[model samples]
Target: MLDYHIHTTLCGHASGSMEEYIEFALTQPLREIGFSDHLPMIKWAHPEYAMPFEKLLEYVQRVLALRQTYPQLPIKLGIEADYYSPAEEAATRSLLAQHPFDYVYGSVHFVEDWAIDDPHNLDQWERVGVDTVYELYFAQLQKAARSGLFDIVTHTDLPKKFGHRPTKDFSALIETTIRSYKDAGMVVEINTSGLRKPVKEMYPAIEILKLLKKYEIPLVFGSDAHAPDQVGRDFAQARQMAQACGFTEIAVFEQRKIVDTYPL
Candidate 1:
């Protein structure tokens, strides 16, 4: 199996060297792995949330060197780029074109200036209202999928990270969100990190998974690991969850495109 959403020390919030994360993956039953540390903050510069602008080359160099260090393992180069407003699309694309990224994960951690997933911003929920936060969060996600700036969409339905649920019915919004992914030929990551969060569930929850299976959008497994031991953190349950949702294969990407797929 493969775990594609691993992070590196370059992203200030994550710990461990790139080598440590890879070494731990080797100990698991993993055949392939990828480093998708948070891309440098664009339109905003937050040192604690992502790597600094100057470290982009450093991040790329380190991951490429690992291929030479461990020729036996298939290590992929990737980045988890946050999805900002549509106005910032051009700037984001210009930054992403600087390197040969195997895959780019389009993620939505912020709704406006406040990060919905950050513990420090928990009070923002009260200010913005939980229901409105959910609506705005999914809207930003739909825009990200349609922008065609990324290969895989990471951690769909992320507002529930702190156990806050929407008071309104968002079935139509959810279906439309998945449709944006389908229309753009995007892959959705079945992120296992949610299980570690207070929600105690996977990202894109079971209901979203069924829609993914129904819509025939491809799948990829991600631990969204911040440290070494988090690699393949909950595969036994994640794979079982995927099979139950009718997913038989997971995608493998290269140079920002899917090269092939691995059986689930």
Candidate 2:
């Protein structure tokens, strides 16, 4: 098994060091583990949530050094980047180009100024209709995929973090989101973190996974672990869900490319 979305303490909200995560992966039956800490935001600075911009180099060098120290374990350095809007595309591209990341996971944690996925903003969900929120989120996700700035889309259905569901069926929206990913030639991560969230289910829900399979979009597994013990957590269940969705292979990346794959 491979976990391509592991985070370290460098991402302020997470605990444990990169080495600690590697040590934990060694205890699991994992073939590869990628360190994908939160990328420093160019427009925002939340030290409590992510590393400062100045620490980017240190974070990369630390992961590179670990690769040498743990030659037996396949460790890939990756980043979880937030996609805000087209206005910031150039800056986002420039920042990402400066680093030689194995993969960049694009995500949308906000819709305009609202932090829809933030726990502190859960009350805001009650102020707006669930369908409206879903529309904004999927729109942002589509834009992120078309931005051509990511190898994988992390936590595809993250807006449901607080378990809010649209009164109307999201079949069309789900299909459109999957189509956007397919059009971009990008992979989607079945992030296991949702299992620990209020939603209590893997991200890119089963229905969405079925649509992804129907479109033949490649899938990848990510624990989205913020701690050592969380590495590879619930991966078996994630894999089982993928298999049920008719996926037999999961993607692996190197130098920002899908270099290989492993069977589910």
Candidate 3:
């Protein structure tokens, strides 16, 4: 198994060092592990959300050192970047170009200015209405896919973070997003963090996964770990889900490209 969405303490909200995660992976049955810490944001500097811009080089150096030390393990350096709008896309691209990441996980954690995924503002879910929030979330996600900035799209249905379901059918929106992802040659990550969150399920829900399978979009697995122990957590379940979704192969990346795959 390969888990590509790991995080380290440099992201502020996570714990442990990059070496600790690699050490933990060495004990697991993982074929590859990637450290995709939150990319430093020029617009959002909240330490809890990502690493400070000044620590960017330090983060890269640390990961590179670990890759050298753990040659036996296929450790990849990656980043989880947020997509806001077209205006910010150029800056985000420039920041990404500064590093040679194995893969970039694009995600939308905010809609406009509201941090919809933050537990501190869970009340916003109700304020925005489930229908409106899902629309905004998918719209931003489509834009992210079209931006050609990410190797994998992380947490496809994160707007349901609070377990609030849209009152109306969103099949069209979901299909459009999946089609856009396929059109852009992006992979989708079945992130397991949702299982540990209020949603209590894997991201990109079963229905969404079915659509991904229908479109033949390559799938990947991410534990979305914030700590050492969470590395590869619930990956067996994620694999089972992928198999059930009709995916026979899962993707692994190197230098921002899917260089190999593992059976589901």
Candidate achieving the largest lDDT: 1
Error of 2 at 115 (Å): 1.9
Local distance difference test, each candidate: 0.92, 0.89, 0.90
The alpha-carbon deviation from the true structure for residue 228 of candidate 2, after best TM-score superposition, in angstroms, is: 0.5
TM per candidate comes to 0.99, 0.97, 0.98
Candidate 3 backbone collisions, by pair: none
Off by over 4 Å in 3: none
Residue-level lDDT tens digits of model 3 in 127-165:
888899889999999999999999899999998877889
Clashes of each: 0, 0, 0
lDDT of 2 at 81: 94
Write candidate 2's Cα lDDT for 1-264 as tens digits: 899999888778888878889999999889998988888886777786678888999999999999999999988989999998999889999999998999999989888677787888866787877888899899999999999998899999998888998888888888988899999999999999999999999898898899899999888889999889999999999888899889999888989888898888
Q: Deviation in angstroms for 262 in model 2?
A: 1.1
Candidate achieving higher TM-score, 1 or 2: 1
The 10-residue segment with the lowest total lDDT in model 1: 9-18
